[model samples]
Target: MKKIYFLIALFCTVLLHSQERYFLNSDTRLYTSPNTSSAFLGYFRYGAEVRLLSESQNGWYKVQADNFNEGYIQEKFAATRLNAKDVKIKDAENPILEGGDAYYGGNHLFVLVAGLKARALPDKNSKIKEILFTGDPVAVDYVPVNEDDWVNINGNFDEEYARYTLRKFIGLRPNFETLIKDFDNLDVNAVSERKTLSERIVELAWNSEYSKLEPAYQRYYEVVKQINDPKLIAETEMNMALAKGLAKHKLPEQIIAFTKKAEFSLKGTKTKSLYLSQTELVKTFGKPAKKANVGDECGIYLSDLFYYYPDLEVSVDEKKNQAEIVKVYINENNKFIINPNTILDNSVSEKAFIEKYGTYIEASLKSPHNYSIIMEDSQFRLVFKDGKLFSVEIFFYC
Candidate 1:
């Protein structure tokens, strides 16, 4: 065990050592890209140097300067040696442009509206420098970006950004999750048709191959979790489940929906629908009635399996509120349903179901409540009642 662990550690160490770091030249601006046309994140005065984290790629150096976890700069403006003093003069092209406030209007983080391009001189027509993808982080100065407006990246690197796209794109750097959680409160929907852009990006990630999902979804996934709205959470989680199902099981949501006898099959699964799982299924158990006593009147649950709700029902015995046994039934009559309001047929075979859900813990079940199949990092739980499919329940920290 120790030897195996040592090999793993050694391999990781070697991998880390393979990448190289370098220094940026003093008295130049650190643009977000290798080209000179890109928006300058900040000016590195003479004697000011930044850390580079990798070999130059396409004439651009990957950096970790300022508040940025990953950033880019041109090779033309870097020096191999460190400055002995911090007295170097600032450059003119990328002047700090502050009206005398050291904090650049007192804010330190910003973001680019989807598709906003960075310009050479903060002027839209000054020759487009770089194109910022939707949600790309931006660093800037406080002065009003004149092409339309100006923002300031202050900090060791902090800058102000426009909530909506403007001459200069800028805003706060509070992580995607925070921004999205409060999307209903912010006024950043003007650029890139932000609402559409947000959905489009996430949808792309949902459909992307597993290996291709990183860097792309790395942020949005985190954001969706922090959102408080149940509708939004369900929508996002569903997207993620589909993406995972595709990656791990090679079964698209369509097939999954086809296997369930739910209402979603009525219209057919949407092209972007999520692979429904235990989390959504368990939601059907809204509030299990409290049990009164051992054989008390445990009311029977009505069947409501259709379009949105799966075949699910919960029955609890109550002698007046004492307590006994509560039974949750996810009957076989349930159907698989998907979005844009579609319904999957009830004719899907057991083989098709296994293909998407993977092998179960126990090949054969003797009782419904005795077995369950889990998926999505245990976010869902599938209960089998008396050797047959029963109900789905949320199992994660949920």
Candidate 2:
């Protein structure tokens, strides 16, 4: 029995030593399972350490905060080393927190930089009490103080009084999760009202939410103008122009010109529609539901083949071995989508179409009340009947 007890003690020690330690980079809640909707076990502040009990799966990890606290956490919020200090904060010129008279009557401030140093006193040379990280909320009282560059941190930093750099904290935290949720719902008003324009722009630019791209770009443009920063203005204008052009399905040459001048890439912008080959079309739409050889109207083509899919029709010129015309039929249940903002459906109106695609090169009357419009550069043709768009055709000019 003595030998068994000694072996059990040795095994427990080995298990404890084998557990890998991870430091939280962002304040994260411990969940009962690897899901956000699950009941929370506890909340761990940034800079807190946890033992990795299980490997990461589906962006979550089973971690143990202490002997009594074992739960799951998001893998992105934790790192192998306590190196939140390494994450650089952009736009350092405009520090989120300002010193002196800028202090408002707020009870808490969020840490902007990871691994922010908290000292025992207001001086930099004072002994360090603890390190705060990004997103960590520090409680404070906004009483008048003579120190212009330092602020007293209250109970949030381990119960002991500490001093942190005044400019490192922000009155309002960037709520990226709420922004993302609002963006998904296309709540333009809510998204536009979110603070932290620069940070929000970065997140929205990286997202593939095409339906709200134009609105978001417009909002960014409005907000950026207020900033009066030349670099930011140029960037926002370029991005907004790209978003507008993409929504309108501008010519490939025009798109290339816009992209060349822009500093960043739009998430899902593609210029391949102007010169779609048979292989590319096949790859995009899979096998067509029907195919047939049709008489060629243009003398340049030897034969024309019509390929029909759910709500799309492709006219392939056999001699050139390229798709000459692509027609999209819009209906209530159509799955055809040109972009996030441009969906081929009955919901699109003639005015809306013109607004989305930009100015047309020429407009001709097909009949007494029907009209056929050719877009700029003659790459697209739109047919309208009774002031409503019927079909949109992509014309691949040789």
Candidate 3:
């Protein structure tokens, strides 16, 4: 009995320690106690692994850094997982240097990954110049690429230029303090600047691969929380919540609940509601760009007319005087917004779609030639072609 109790106690201790381990999301100071006023023990860099010594106290975490230096750090600055790909580059408006005539002189990027290698050339096999850690700054010559392309650092080069993967860099350097101050003062310029920054952040989050979507949105959420706008804050919260659900491939019932809670507004189409008459739609959006008889193509007995718009296509049944179905094409000019906050466009990958909406109900038989997938619920259907979102179909019920 005594031996069993001892082994049980040892197992519990090991499990507790394993569950408490976390990584620093940002550079944070280690305090001697849970209070900020307490004496400073040391500082931990981003991506530093630490073990929680105790439960959170007043939003502070009792952490043991380096398995020895026990201290307290703010809970918000720590994450269960490392987010090395959440890097951001300084925008043109907020340049690294105040003045420079050179085109790429002011461009600067932040390293999000710990131990990111800086190679002598663009190739992965090239000699490594140095290893960069999270939050490390690097000035560049031009705008960083969005894909797995490489960019040359400003000063880390010699006869051969030093390069790093561009996908690891975000586009804007957010200054939350300045933004809050400007917002409080009702600065118009600041509002415009922040809008641009927000758009860039949203683009980055939306374009991220399915595997990285959570961290990308999490980083965006952190930025959104600093802004002094209630509407934007609410929208961000909705987006984050929806993203979490989608990333997990939630069930139809759960998705319904999420959509109901979000109460997303339809901004792309002229009509406010999906259940609108042809006359109402025309009154709101004027004449369609093109009108076609699609009844025969659809094999529908009723006389159906398909009205094509820049952002949407509506199939109206003449017998009912109501739209039977509405289709939104996901393209470069993605003006159609079924969900304004969670916009899906051509940039979204098929893998991302599968990850978000779960398995497809139907797929194109002619593979290697023309590939497509169809995922449907009661009201909405998503169609993907060639590993990209092609269109979203909305069905109307009587």
Candidate 4:
């Protein structure tokens, strides 16, 4: 037995030495791409230690965690070791506690020894998102896949493991029958935080793949289309892509064209059609300044220039076939502004949400009974009740 233990320890030490390390002596930088010249996403703080996935040729290390592995890290921070002690738990692994289950859906794990320091995410290079680090014993959850590798964990909101390294904790499965009594005070807030964390993963995945704002604004439009929150979906489409496109692309709004096309030069010029379809109007004058819609029925966009001159009133009929332009009161306050469109989509997925939302909100709103709320600029709010979805609401400002 002594020989076995010695051999295992020796092997671990050798593995650690072979792997590279990145030091968070200062603001540890997180990059968007594997190349150093890529845009920066964020950084880790001082006194943090992160392991490198591999050694790069250009004096850079491919370190994982803190969402920084997307790019190569400077070689100066590389460490020549891996020092994580093998984790083991007592008892048959019980993933779902009677009343304690942290539901953030990434790679999760439970600390085997009582009172283990659960850091934010899985690595030291990651940012701190939660206000609390400790969690109720019952709140701890895990999935043991093999004797040496646990698949998942249930840590407190801030005491989370990284999604990618969940397999590392499989050795710590505890038998439910022999486990001590679960924490009497089940923290509802912790559960909600967990759910939010899960959602954040979804957001991040979505943004990473679609929200890079590349391939033009088509991806943003697709995301909004999948969202049930009409308000958010509408608002994001209008504010982020459509509006920006109008100004940047020089697309004219359809409604405003009615006024523009009507030539007052011929006093009482009898026109065949007063109002025109936004698409048709754009063809006559220019493309839309900004436009976003849900399906083909509901959507709202604005023109580049507002008719500040009260003399012209632009109104569209229900059929969208006619427009009546007449003299009306004009208010300087009612100005036509081009706003960018935001991305809103249920399809953003769970992994994407975690990457985007992070852990700050989860730890701050640590209420056993309280839930999670995600708000964007589009007057759209997503509410989760007791760690699950509660509601999604959208409203019009005007």
RMSD of each: 21.3, 20.7, 21.5, 21.4
Ranking by lDDT: 3, 2, 1, 4
Worst 10 residues of 4 by lDDT: 333-342
Q: Each prediction's TM-score against the native?
A: 0.24, 0.26, 0.27, 0.20
Best of the candidates, TM-score: 3
How would you encode candidate 3's per-residue C-alpha lDDT over 1-398 as one tens digit per residue?
Answer: 99999888867865686576577675556677777788765444445566776556689877765414467888887777766674422233322232243322333555544356776666789788776544345664332222465655543324354365444452333333343344345444455554544444444333333433455456555556656678767556645544554465545555564333211123444344455676766775578899897536535423457888876777776567776436666676543334445556678865554445442222211121122222233455566676677766654333
Stretches off by above 4 angstroms in model 1 are 1-110, 119-130, 135-168, 184-398
Candidate 2 per-residue C-alpha lDDT over 1-398 given as tens digits, one digit per residue, 9 for 90 to 100: 99999888867755763465567675567788999899774445455556676656899977765322568888887786767364522223222232233323323566554356777765788888776654456654321112244655552333265455553343455454555455455543543454354345333333323334466566556556766689778656645544554455545555434323211111222323434467766776678899998665554332367888876777765456576436665455332244344444566655555445542223311132222333334334556665565665655444
lDDT of 4 at 390: 30
Q: What is the per-residue lDDT of model 1 for residues 343-368, given as tens digits with 9 covering 90 to 100?
A: 32344333334344432222211121
Indicate the residue-level lDDT of 91 in model 3.
31
Where does candidate 2 clash, by residue pair?
A: none
Backbone clash pairs in model 2 (N, Cα, C under 3 Å; residues 3+ apart or in different chains), count: 0
Each prediction's total of clashing residue pairs, residues at least 3 apart in sequence or on different chains, is 57, 0, 1, 55
Angstrom error at residue 38, model 3: 99
Q: Largest lDDT belongs to which candidate?
A: 3
Question: Candidate 3 deviates by what RMSD?
Answer: 21.5
Give the TM-score (vs. native) of candidate 4.
Answer: 0.20
Reference-based lDDT, each prediction = 0.40, 0.52, 0.53, 0.34
What lDDT, from 0 to 1, does candidate 4 have? 0.34
